[model samples]
Target: MPTARPRLLYVTDLAYPARGRRYGDEDVFLTSRLRAEFDLALCHPGDAVSLMDAFDAVVVRNSGPVLTYPEAYAAFRERAAERGTPVFNPLTGRGDMAGKGYLTDLTAAGYPVIPTVDRAADLHRLPETGRYVVKPRLGADSAGLRTVTPDALRAVLAEGAATGADLLAQPHVDFVHEISFCFVDDAFQYALYAPRPDRRWELAPYRPTLADLAFARRFIDWNALPYGVQRVDACRTPDGGLLLVELEDLNPYLSLDALDDGTREAFVTAFTASLRRFLAV
Candidate 1:
């Protein structure tokens, strides 16, 4: 007798109008591939909490920014935890899955990240630059991100303080280009980069050097998720060193379309194997 495949409730927002990215196309391609190994059902993120209990695990991908549906996301997290339903990325994620506060944690730990602070008094910790970036600690996809002068940032923080809003501030780094390291489980898969600084989604295949892989691995080591996918985004400083931009552990938009057929297939295989391993545990 053949073994039964795991049932996976895949959560995504296919209609989300992501700037310079195709959330629908990527998720479509991925779920199509994933269907070979699992009984997969795709649903809008809003419906995940209701649908997930019937499946063996929930694979959250391209669900859009939680800022758009904070309450729904919160409920989903709560329900999943209460029922002990296996989540693909798992709730233990410490990076973007949790929130941008990880940036402040990394900064304080002296990780190679753009210095981030959330309070008015902590502003002095960041180096003085022409401008600083003020963004919500829970923000994603550049939502609620802005550049401002130091004085303006202080005012923003002051307002946040008054309103009790979660916010973070960081020095604007003059970086040469942005790159991302994609991984399945803890193993590296592929890398992509934006050659043009202005175009964040205009990605091209990047060949990582041993040094580059080492730098990206630092965050992977930090998060230490036993399974699931991750993307380590970083920028090249003028001094030829890398500073982390973000570590996306939850539903990272894998530029599968950008990869060659072989590479894309390899990612699917790795992802499938990871899911099986995750199920075993």
Candidate 2:
């Protein structure tokens, strides 16, 4: 039912005011490139539910955290399901899109993920650390994350329990650096890393080894997304092994500017091809 050039409803918040990054600039660049292949219109996350039905598919990017507009997001999801509206990230993601619960599941299953537990009673499962990172299960973009002492960890979890809010706790990892593997439709596109964990947005291009690719690929295969972008974030341990920090399956930032010209062009080409393939289905 699509015309010569299919219509795409590109969802984004151009002025999200995030920390250490310009979400608007990145999205403007992406949309400019994407316009070459499709008739695209960008809309705010709050407007997508009302405007999406007219477009062939909706591409969510730079929309910021769901907590900012929970009601709008829930309505969007509900309407999309009722009408079977095509979403690029496909709503069946089992990773962060669902919640942080997958981290605990992966930990229990013996994956290389940093050990995580949702309930206070499960604290014994996590390694002993002077400080633990306690975060809300449904949080994103470090919205409800905190680093606290052991006593504070229990107090916070208990307080969350009293209020019927879900939380997860993990040991603070002492890693040499944080690396991210970017992918498009289950295929590896490129990789980047930050030497100093304190400066998360200051990234440099990384040449991944076979073992490194294997480590990242395992999580990609586990997620098994039909189509869309994914970023597998991991930390390099002192002993030269990687641990899964998080699996970002929904609207993961591509960080295209950090890449060289050739690599950036290749990524855009692959992303366009992947979108075409996704639309075909």
Candidate 3:
């Protein structure tokens, strides 16, 4: 008899319409490849809590913003924690998975992150810039993101965390380019960049310098997930340096189609290995 493969509950929303990315195609391509090594099953994010128990582990990928279904996501988290289910990103992510609040935390800790302030009273902490970015503390994919003058920003801040409206404010960054470092667990897989800041989805392979690797690895080390996929996004400042833009740990859309066949295969191989390790734990 053949050895039984681990059963995996792959959570995704194939119908999600991402602005600059194709969430469906990437998940489709990945699950097709993943089928070779695991007894894989796909389900929407809303259904994960109900069906996850039968699987060895749950692999959350491109399930769309949790904001769309916060209650379901919360329930999933609660159930997973209750059962100590091994989630791929390991529910321990402190980055975007948990919320954008980490931006404020990272800034305070003096990580090379964009200065983020959660309180309106703390507006003075931000740099004197032409404009400021105001977005929901739990925002994802630029949802509810906006810009305003310092005066307008103050008024919004004065409203004061009314109910669930607490916002994150930052000096609008005029960066040269945006880049992302993809990693599996703690191992750096590859880098990609968008030359034009406006064209975020038009990505190209980026060859990272030693310094670049050092910067990206700082956050990966900080996140400390033993097994999972992560992407450290950063932007090139006007002074020719990179600052942490975001650390995406939960269901980050891997632009697999952007990579060459070899690179894609390498990622899949690494992912397969990582999943096996996670299941064993």
lDDT by residue (72-94, candidate 2, tens digit) is 99999999999998898988888
lDDT of 1 by residue, 14-72 (tens): 99999988999999998888888888899998999888888888999999988899888
Alpha carbon lDDT at 131, candidate 3:
94
Clashing pairs in 1: none
Task: Rank the candidate models, highest TM-score first.
Answer: 2, 3, 1
* Model 3 TM-score (2 dp): 0.97
Candidate of highest TM-score:
2
Tell me the lDDT of model 1 at 29: 90
TM-score of each: 0.96, 0.97, 0.97
TM-score of 2: 0.97
Which sections of candidate 3 miss by over 4 Å? 1-3
> Where is the poorest 10-residue window by lDDT in model 3?
155-164
